[model samples]
Target: AEEARQTTQFEPLPKSLFQPLPPFEDLPRPLSPSGASALIDEAKQAVIDTGSPVLDTEAEPGFAVMRGLALHKLLQMLPGIAEAERRDAAARYLKRAGAQWPETERDKALASVATILADSHFDQLFASNSRAEVAVMGRLEVKGKLRSISGKIDRLAVTSGKVSIVDYKTNRPAPATLADVPPAYVLQLALYRALLQPLYPEHEVSAALLFTEAPRLIELPPAVMDNALARLTGA
Candidate 1:
């Protein structure tokens, strides 16, 4: 019995069989517009990590964050309401949603919403043909990797001549020039343009950032969008 046992040669299992499986790259990567923006520009993530004042300077960020969200909600719902009723409706909505907020903050948000609704520059955006909270989904090639991105456009306007994508911003002092705009914002708008162009091939697709704080609309130029796309795809 001892000789039989000694003669039995036992081979070890292959290490490859025990190795961890490679990352699953085939699955679609779910990324929001903001997330894709940050992924494309590492600096954006760095700025977030550092809490750059350009983003926020709140002693208590929770209030600021919630305030922004409340404003966004108002913007989303305001377009559906009659323009004449928007001001009173906005006041009521904010009063309910912002009961815990300081009176000043609530009033400020109400004023901002009123200003955005009344801005003649954004008249086309709130037109009958426009849609708010538009869901967009598409696959984009990012530096040799394919990724799926999905996000909701704050507002999308479809006209006979053009398809407009508008993203609202609440920055206290919005970017004054194209050069001053954040890289992430540019990337976000550019990606939206790419995703929506195929849907409206006959019409020109345009994107812009509407700063609600001061009610300014800054349209991104074709050259700027093209450059951002080139950088994102590593072309």
Candidate 2:
């Protein structure tokens, strides 16, 4: 038995090692936002549900879809650009984004692009801060109910010692009024304020939601914001 065991151990391993490695090249790449959202019956269902305690990683993909659309619109509105040139630029961006989207979602994203451009409020704000210090992907960490909270600020603009935190929304038929805005969104901006206040002591920081679809800018009320901060910090 010892002699037999020694002979088996010395034998060359079988050619079928680990049942052959998977054909990695044949595997599909991770799905894009459009592709993933298409898998759901309703695109809205793809929106990250914030009810879970864990931070919403899935939110970025949908936000990316909206960001692409917002960029296209912002490009068209750049000052001093010829109307034809602006439209062409916006069209190119839309085409690139649409290529990866399902036909249904592509149509919706395209339609929403014009909505932002049509909003007087968005235009006024963008024009006013054309030279403001803009920060994208602003990151912050804060205490939360169950654990620490971390999030990315969509846009941060500081002008003349006044800091404005803007959160963009891509929801269809964006909230018509401040009251229509979601509590979660309001809480998010408040938390951003809490995190940024110490870093910019001299600047007066404020938070607002820029509903890209409705193109409305709704500032958070002082009372509501104070309450959110109190709850977040347990102060």
Best by lDDT: 1
Q: Which candidate gets the maximum TM-score versus the true structure?
A: 1
| Per-residue lDDT over 1-235 for candidate 2, one digit per residue giving the tens place of the 0 to 100 score | 9999998889777889859687775533332211221222223443332431112234455545555454534533543355446555555665775565555554555555555544565554455454332433223222332323345555666678877777666555567888776665666677667667888899998888776544567899767877755544445
Span of ten consecutive residues with least summed lDDT in model 2: 31-40
By summed lDDT, which 10 consecutive residues of candidate 1 come out lowest? 46-55
Q: How accurate is candidate 2 locally (lDDT)?
A: 0.55
Candidate 2: list runs displaced more than 4 Å.
1-84, 100-120, 123-150
What is the lDDT for 7 in model 1?
A: 63
In angstroms, give how far residue 231 of model 2 lies from its true place: 1.6
Candidate 1 per-residue lDDT, tens place, 96-182, comes to 888998898788889878887887877899888998889999988887988787888989999997999999877666668877777
